[model samples]
Target: MESPKIDIITLVENLAYQQGTKGEHGLSFVVRTSGRQILFDTGQSDLLVQNAKKMNVDLSAIDAVVISHGHYDHTGGLPAFFEINDHAPVWLKSKAFDEKMSKSTGTPRFIGLDPEVAERYRTRFRTVEQVTELAPGLKIVPEIGSYYGFEQPSQSMLIKHGKTLSADLFEDELFMVFEHSEKLVVFAGCAHRGIGNICRSAMSLTGCNQIQLVLGGTHLKGASKGRIAKTVDAFRDLQVEHFGLCHCTGLPAFMEFSRVFEEKVRYAHVASRFEPFD
Candidate 1:
């Protein structure tokens, strides 16, 4: 059977020209492919829900929901999603429950997933510690592990490991891949594991070098100049043809991306749809 057409729609973001739409400090994408629809990362709040409603995007067709990490900004819409998605399995890393927080030279705040909410949807949760194929052409990848690249985890975020405070290794971060024909289209939510790491891992997962498009948050906000340069180099080395960058990518880094990738670097905001093929 021929592969079903793949369509990605941005339900929430903090960028671009979608009139009469609202933006947020979060990200969410609705994936439709292979006779299945996937909701990738619920935005900060009901922002995604409200936006989808405004755009007349139906949420009832969602076959599954994949969370990128344990951060509140990414997983806060769990309640809203649960109401609309029927009982689709919530996919994420097994460590999604880790106590997370950030200390930015001020009072540290809880940035982890809500225990009460997770408990409520415990039966519908599907945690994966390794790569798992959700369908014929869709897969949820686990941790990207260590990569000695310029894309490093934020130093401010920390995880509570019992009585110890451990640096947030972002073990909960995961990226989704959609394979069509002989091409691979990758989506990284927040990409705390590093874009270079994500690209390398995506190639490894698909076992092919032909990446159709690299979309979603790169989390490169406020990155150093040297780091950004090396990251763009990695993109070039990997031959990433298109990038749909948005959410926390920062103006400076995004500008660099646009300069390097030129027309290949399109900002994905509210109502932005990406169909790499045809």
Candidate 2:
């Protein structure tokens, strides 16, 4: 069977854009394929709505919204997004814990979303605690645990008595997989658990060893050169052709990846777009 064509629109940025252009923190992508509209993740703010409006993306028509994790950066726009449309199913990992944090500097805050926001979708949002296929070729792999000697802890986010704090690292991250014609387009948020682990888990779920495209943050800001090199070698071995790295992918790691992957690597900036084929 022929695969559905996918169109991904970048809705947020972590760095400055063209001259005089500003950057938005966090990440989000609208994946349109197989006549289905999937909102991957909402950035750290409502810039996604603005970007979507700029790109002529209609959120009201979105079939589903998947939260890669519970970080404020990724879920901050949920309240606004929900205001736009409340019909689509909000699929999230059962353990998708998000907490509030202080704005100044960066400190552990509260745990979970604000009451105002939670009330909006309290009855509609659904959580999937296990690995399951949501559609013909789309599957959600929930909390693969940890990777890179780290448990992939995310900040506990919440608001308490008008104060916010970073909560805890409750296992809440997930990755989305799209399989078409035996090719895989894996979508990740921060990839806190480790990009390699995500890919391995995806392979295990789909039973397809080939990863054609990997787009999203790699969470390698503090990674050492050796670790980055190892990651690149793994991608090379896996034969992933298109890599769209952004957000916390960091400068040093991205530069090294570009040098190593060359044509295969694409620095993922806001407004960056691409289509993968085999």
Candidate 3:
């Protein structure tokens, strides 16, 4: 039997794929599959809702909302989303509500989800610490086990617990897996735990090696050339059939991927639509 078609429409990203749609340094996608609609990430502002309106995506019909991590860029639009959809449960990792910070710009800045929004909609949030099946074929897989040495977390990322601050290990990072037929379609927000690690986790969790598509950020922005090379090698080893990379994947890394993967890779920008199963 053929797999069910999975249609992914980019609602927000750092670049715009269609005219009239604004872009921002964040990510959001409306995924439709098996008669269900899933909102993946909410971007850094109201762009998700605004773009969704322009694209004719009905936010009120979203069956569920999956947040890849605690970063503001991915979770900041929760308030806007809540205003429209009141029933869909927001799924995220256990530590997704913890205070997150980034010092990459030489000054510490809070990067986690808004405390007010999280507190206000606490009842609608569903925190998951392990592999969980949100629906029949949709699974929320947390980043677990070991990580490749080359895929280290950025030192500038920090997590705060009231007064104490520590390195952001990104334990809250997770990815969405859509199992169709015998193949997998992986969706990530920023891949803050490393795209390679997330891919490996998906393979290990499902015992399936055929990843028909991988869409979303790889978090390779400003990474070392060597690291990018190693990541490319990892992708080659994993045999990911198609890559729809965007956001933090960076131009240099995307260029390298396009050089290697060629026709199999694409820069998925805002308003871009992808049907991986097609």
Candidate 4:
């Protein structure tokens, strides 16, 4: 049988302007194709399940869950999620369980996912070392090493290993690649590893230069003007078709990208749907 065309829908995000469903500082998306329906990033709380209920979405039907990283804002909903769907593999990086914390105020704050919850469903977790194809025309892109100069690893986010704290290189950050309309569409968790890095890694892995859409968070909220401008210029140079940006893409950066991309950019808020042929 021929592969199915992919359709992605933003189920829950940090903002919900018109969806009636509540939003929080997190992200979650539902990617549907003919063979498998995947849930990407479960948001910061059980709110994902609540919002899915409001949208008439059946969480039990999800074939698997693709977590972006170990951050709670993206993985915190797993406990509640697993409750709804008795069983489904959670795909993430191999070392995704590493302890992660942030010290923005010079005081450590836990930013990683709940360990107790993850331990409870450890059997369902799938550790990915590199790019792995989940199904025909669908793949999980993992650990795209840094390639851009401006998008350096954050010092605030730290990981503790054997009494040592080092910058969280975001080795756990990952993205999904799906073939649709003969174009490659990227479903990013948070792009915690830089959007350019992810796009470039995807191209290198798939050997495809044309990216149809880059959907989800870019984590560019706190980036400098020069960096944002350079990023926009880079995408333009890449000839990217559409950008469904949301979450950590700060207001200023988003506006800059909006001006550059025009109607090709849309806020990937809760309930936003990305179906090319629709």
Q: Tens-digit lDDT track for model 4 on 108-133?
A: 77789788987878898988877777
TM for every model, in the order presented, reads 0.95, 0.85, 0.96, 0.95
Write down the RMSD of all candidates, one decimal each: 1.4, 3.7, 1.3, 1.5
Clashing pairs in 1: none
- Better-scoring candidate (lDDT), 3 or 4: 3
lDDT, each prediction: 0.85, 0.73, 0.88, 0.84
User: By TM-score, highest first, what's the ranking?
Assistant: 3, 1, 4, 2
Candidate 2 Cα lDDT to native = 0.73
lDDT of 1 by residue, 44-84 (tens): 88888888887788887788889999988889988888887
Q: How many residue pairs clash in each candidate?
A: 0, 18, 0, 1
**Candidate 2 ranges beyond 4 A from true positions:** 16-22, 98-107, 110-112, 143-170
lDDT of 3: 0.88
Question: What is the lDDT, from 0 to 100, of the residue 236 in candidate 3?
Answer: 81
**Residue 67, candidate 2: alpha-carbon lDDT:** 87
lDDT of 3 by residue, 146-184 (tens): 658788888999998988889999989889898877788
Model 1 segments beyond 4 Å from truth? none
